[model samples]
Target: MKKLVLFLTVALMALPLKVKADEGMWFLMFIERLNHRDMQKMGLQLTAEEIYSINNNSLKDAIVQFDGGCTAEIISKEGLILTNHHCGYDKIAELSTPQDDILTNGFWAKSKAEERAPKNISVRFFVRMDDVTKRILGVTNPNMTEAEREKAIKAEIAKIEQENNEGGKYTVSVRPFFQGNEYYYFVYQDFEDVRLVGTPPNAIGKFGGDTDNWEWPRHTGDFSLFRVYTDKDGNPAPYSPDNIPMSPKHHLPVATSGIKEGDFSMILGYPGRTNRWMPAQGIEQNVSFAYPAWVEGSRLGMDVMKKYMDQNDEVRLNYASKYASVANYWKNRQGMIDALKAHKTVEKKTKEEKDFNKWANKKENKATYGKVIEDINAYYAATNEKSRHDNYLMTILRTSDMGALPYSLGSAFSQYMEASPEQRAEMKPYLVNGINESYATLALPLEQEMLAKQLQLYATKSTGFDIAPYVKEIGSKSNNDFTAYINNAFANSIFASEEKAMAFLENPNADVLNNDELFKLSSDLIRQYNTVPENVKTLQNDYQKSYRLLVDGLRKANPDKKYYPDANSTLRLTYGKVIDLPRGNKVNDAAENWYTTLQGTIAKHKAGDEEFEVPQRLIDLYNNKDFGTYADENGVLHVNFLTDHDITGGNSGSPVLNGKGELIGLAFDGNIEAMAGDVIYDPKLQRTINVDVRYILFIIDKYAGATNLIEEMTLVK
Candidate 1:
């Protein structure tokens, strides 16, 4: 039985350490060893089933879709819920007023009545999906012409949907995972009453803030709490005073005595994206050029934004989010590059690729397999040319000057330049077919301003041939200093870079700004982008195509492998018994991992510090027997749980469950070393950072003294 399972795994998976479209080379084996199962066992996962049964009395009525975003499992008979702190940032930020800094001070429901309302926050659940893979692929045989297969599959999916009855509130989403290796259908139940329940101040929740972001051996307490509500009829509704808490099937017990290193664990939530199956060349390009270049460019741009934001409070407020987003991705890319350099993930992968290809060729699997891999690699290589299409198509990497004028122009012409044929069907009259919408989003000169800052930052931070030499070499474009040139561009450009534009914005003399037809046109373009986000539609279609190719291919070749498609932003079951990955010996005198300890924080604390010190509650908990149960190898309470769970940004609110499928921790950030997994998933290095349920419970009971919230749930000490 083990051999059979092993064979099936190696014959069908995207292994953590390999790139086989039809096998789990190493990852599948690893997961199997952890006693993890695929979708077949998903139905048998009682916790998951219990979650499903909450919305309805039967699993049959509980719909789970793959396309669903913001995954939420029913936690209690009354709709009290759980998710990550960062996931609720937008809602918290929205509800916070100028005088009330919920982000900094944090907010907890004093009682049920104190849960703050957020207009835009939402929670969604998977409803259902009809496995239409056979119908989808039936029209396109592996032997069929590519064009013929494409047409047939399209017709088939449409037909399937047309024939099936869909719940009015539900929507069908087809996602591509493992590149173009697979596809799956997801149905979802979206609710609008998500509210902020509790969040630690940024000092703790986002401890170390951006500087510590995307880093590992991390100490960030990245959990924020929220609650879900439903209409009186027990359905999703926009937030209203009349709305009440949602009814859930279960609320996880707070495991005060937390997990041991080798215990069973699982993370169930919406993981954004993972590229564990890219060909070697793709890896090379990323490590050598793509990631490094993007990181450098982003760092420069961020420097500029920081300067302006620091000096101007209004500017800071407006751009804090924008800064975090770019910085977040930049941090991830840098981490990946660093980790790739630190270890031999790329080398091992390359070696494995060679072995797989050699074996497949001997088995006569090469003729077709060889060409496909070759095509993907060659196309990837060709597209990544430094100054050409591959990595430099937009010049956005090397040059971050994002002026509004250019963007406005790009958005205007994009009506004709909009790229996707399918997306073209839904394009606004002002949109260009091939042009990117962001080009016009900066018509307000947002890009140019962003670029100006980027250039200034590069000028200051970089040296050698990379940036310093370039600035020095520009020598003076048109009798102006770089800064002056930038100012002129924003002030003079037709993309509304003048005093009049600002004056109009301040008071609103749109008639003057739009006296010309061109102004009217640009206004319409901006309006459309703000309203529809049309580009999303086109991108979605491409993913659908990519998904179909990948999943359909695997289904045809490995039907008996018990495949679980790559995760869509939906509720997924990825189970694994926890395992410790020791990178190296603690330098005889030093600790191997930088955990959040009283000693570490106390030593680091200083007078008049910019960041806050560790909360006293933690110190008291450590000194007293206040800690309920969790402890590390040294018997110090492991206030946090960490693991190499395959995860990403969107997995923020994900619930890290024990083998019993009870929530043990809330999935938040990845350790600094694990950032590379954002671009490259190296099981040995990438880890998910979670707040130990015990620490949280202790903080609530012994620290914050919030016994009411603690008493509401079953906490197993």
Candidate 2:
């Protein structure tokens, strides 16, 4: 049984990652969330036999993957899909200029032809996912110990093919969780082109901005509308004049009712990773070092984005997604840090450890738990030095240092070089024009600020680097003087100088043959910079292995228990009833109200302040309808809902459906209280925020008067 548990831990925790902390009592919660057959009869859900089949083969081909790259819920008979406004903001924003702002004013086509093309946006539906886990893992023995287990798994994956992924819709991977406690597999389809649909201005889509990001009882209209399209016959294809909307048979109806507290809800979409079962030391790294650096870095980035965007409308428009993306994590990280601090996650783990030890000491329970807890800690401790600076810096290094410069150059340089004289003018209004636009000016400043913060944190917290003295030297040099100096330099950067910026921006046909200096330099730097340090990569890879080992162990021990894998950017389902859970006792939290209401919003309102004042647009929208769409018993507008659906990054556009499969709300963001929810998934803390669907309709119906959009939705109400 002991060995059984160890294997189970690794197996179960291995897949798209299972058991974010919220998965506690998951088996019970999922079972509780399960609608009885009679209930299913009314709700239009799978019957028992169907449910059996569905559960047996979650990877089967009932679901469709969006080919062009955005997550969408097919909500209409004619392929009306629902996704976040921000998700499609870019297409809409790009379509609009100073003369037309779809982002601010919004857009709705009066008819099908008028729906307007969204440049290159597309969607995909998965045909199938195979459980190659048994086969994938079959290369190794279940009986193999740690080192031997590692070697076999590597050999197996090596034989699985690395290069010719052309036929691989997406790599389907099987993963273990909790030291091999259980395992699961994921299926995905990737697309490079996606476009915008409709979006409310930032004032609505991100109403409260950074101030209100992760709070509950908050009213913010975070939903946007988008539709996935493809070629006429419904197969994935590049953009062309003759393309048509995707016609999906499994489309959701738009009129699903809103959920009240305790209504069971399910989220269906891709999720990223979570580390729910880390040891005390691992939690310490997250709480003290990692969380702080991330929060600080995000705040710094926000500072840079806000300063530049505030100054330039073009900058704001260009980096709309960038701001929201960073803010998303910013709000959550702060919330998570606060919640974990208040909850004393380490304390909980400590108590858990004590209990486990008690069981381990007992003759019967000893084998099952044994030194598993200790080993988890030991492995995690080894990563501490790397986790500090490397954790935060590495993420930015890949995204900014590596991906940014070259893209900026390419954007400014190569597109229109070969365009025929007339075609150059034609391409100007589209993607080519954006080349002259200096997003690097906007993005790099923000990253530079973030890097400054990270280096400081690294100097303050990280250890064992012989660069200890160099780290300190670098840290002190990066203070205000350094920032000002760098800003001055960046402000006058070659890209910042419009002489060059415009030269690249205006030339629709500036051709670069094999010898463009900037292009070659960029190419060389990208190669030189992106190479992860051998030591760091080795540590990260080993960490991943040990992490999987733990997961595999858990799966073997708890075969009877339902276990889900951690997310690895693949579709998954987490079912639970909507219920408000207590979060921070410090800032402001309540028992019955999981949602932050207008009352709470009002409490935090900065009446005289410019930065935090409620947007007049929101106030007018509120006044016009007086909580126009829906209201809680207290009569305050309810902006979001609280749920235990385990989620992460790719789960962004998921529709949070009730037991009856009604589209009550669109899951957009999570409350700040559970930012730590990603790593620790604390059920008592994390809550999924949703923009009430009815509010979206009311905005369109009452304010925007875009009746066409209103007409498109199949309203259940």
Report the Cα lDDT for residue 180, model 2: 47
Worst lDDT run of 10 residues, candidate 1, spans 1-10
The estimated TM-scores of all candidates read 0.72, 0.73
Steric collisions counted per model: 60, 98
Q: Write the per-residue lDDT of candidate 1 for residues 1-717, one digit (tens) a residue.
A: 000000001111232323221122112212433333342253225433443432445322212111123433434445556555555555556566547877766777868798887655566665555445555655566565545666776776666554543546665565444543444566656777777777776556666567656544345566666677789988878878899887753456555555665565666566545455555666676787666766766676677667776675444544555566567766766777877777666786678556655544555555545434444444445434431112221223333424223445434334434346565445533333213333322223344565545444434433321322333344235321355555664554334434433333234333433343333323432342233224434433433343334334434444455444443354544544444445463221114342344344334443344353566556566567455544554655544546656665566666666655566776667766555554455566556677666655655566556666666776665
lDDT (Cα, tens digit) per residue for candidate 2, span 1-717:
000000001111332233443353222113324433323443436433332233343211223333222345766555566776655655666676556766666666555666655555555444333334665567666466656777876666545434323476455454543444433443344333334445666556656666665555555666666555567666556656576766654555554345577666666665545556665677787677666766666666667667877776666766665666666666655666777787788898778667655655567645544655665666567656555555445334322442245445554345456567697677666643454353433455555665444445445544543223433453466642334543453444444344655554554333432334323333433443344456655554555554554444444444555455455445555666677756445343223565544444444556655334555655665556465545545555555667776676556667766554557777776766667665566666667777667666766665566677766666775
How big is the positional error of residue 208 in model 1, measured in Å on the Cα after superposition?
2.6
lDDT of 1 at 285: 67
lDDT of each: 0.50, 0.54
Q: Report how far residue 583 has shifted in candidate 1, in Å.
A: 6.0
Evaluated with lDDT, which candidate comes out highest? 2
User: Candidate 1: lDDT over CA atoms?
Assistant: 0.50
